[model samples]
Target: MKPRSVRTSVTLAGGVAAVAVALAGCGDTKAGDTTSGSSKVTASPEAPGETGGSGNPTGKATPDTVPGHGKTGQTGGTAARCTAGELRAGWQRQPWSKDGHVFATLILTNRSGRPCTLAAGWATFGKGSSGRYQELRTTRAAMPGAGTTITLKPGTSAFEGVKYDATQGCPTIGGFGVKVHAGWNDVPGGSGPVVLCPDSFTAGTIQPTMNGVNFHS
Candidate 1:
């Protein structure tokens, strides 16, 4: 009987050991599965063409579309037109005379401190005497080409031509002057007395470049 009991105890102890080993194996398998799930949750997504991150597929930046933003051409800002009050006038008479006509160069100088634009157009010729202004009529002549929009910096100048015809018995006029009309401003200009032939006066458009008084004809 003692021997039978000893065999039974050995068998029972062996069975208990086997069960413990099986439990340990199961616990290790469960721990491994938990570690693998944690790694998947913390992992970052892979980028395009990269090992782990996402970015622009083509890798090119966007371009600008705003006008005058990055290209040359007309800028959005325009120069301000010159005012008559900001101009100073002067004249240079040519030495030569032809066909009973005297020629003189008209100069319109900017007196303001800012830059301004001068449009191509006609100017007024007149005399200021006895506290009254008398405007002279400009003889009809062929228009001198198209006038250009000229930009003048501060202290800059523009030029024009004036023709006085003495062939038609011009009245003896003295104290001649020229007036520059820029936009809404009409500024008078002259130096000393301007001896002009009456009823035969003509003026030319303001030119961008200096061509003397003969450029009009």
Candidate 2:
């Protein structure tokens, strides 16, 4: 009788151990789920077409966020990308632009009544002219200070050099469009997109200064 009692007690203890192991397994699974949920908090947004701020398409890596001061290896304060709603555009022809090539500086102003950053690798478009609002096909040119973090304070401006062919039978327009890491906005002010011809145009890099370019990415 005593031996039988001891066997029963041992059996009960084994069952309790098995139950503990099962509970631990369930706990591990729950912990894994919690970790995954935490990661989602910091994940990047998945956007399509065009780019986010800092010139990379949304849903992908963009410099600074180009809000994160991204992997461009360029370091700066983590500033949010400037939005189209906050920006206004305009242009001025460069003094040295010749007869064949129309060289001009594309100016982007921060009209948001606040400060923002325009990441590198911005895109520019020509406004359609002659009772039209067409986006012209403009090319990009390689130049000094083309790709750099441009900090635009309230009422401040960023500049880009544009070179297009005037002799190529390009059409006239009332304004130009500027696209940075964000969407396109009409830069309509003064003479409007004079350097912008609908057919052939080339845009240079953006810089904080109108005269000199920065060579860093």
1-217, model 1: which lDDT tens digit per residue? Answer: 1100000000001011000000011012111121212221121111111001111102111221101111111111247765655555544444444455555445556668877666534444455432233555454222243334556666766655555555544444434433333222222322222334545555554555544223323
Single out the weakest 10-residue window by summed lDDT for candidate 1.
3-12
lDDT of 2 by residue, 154-197 (tens): 67766555445654355544543334332434322222333334
Model 1 TM-score is: 0.51
Residue 208 in candidate 1, Cα distance off native in Å:
1.2
- Model 1 gets an lDDT of 0.36
User: Model 1 Cα RMSD, Å?
Assistant: 48.2
Badly placed stretches (over 4 Å) of model 2 are 1-75, 129-135, 168-175, 179-199, 213-217
Model 1 Cα shift for residue 37 (angstroms): 99
Model 2 residue pairs with clashes: 63-66, 64-67, 64-68, 64-69, 64-70, 65-68, 89-187, 145-214, 146-205
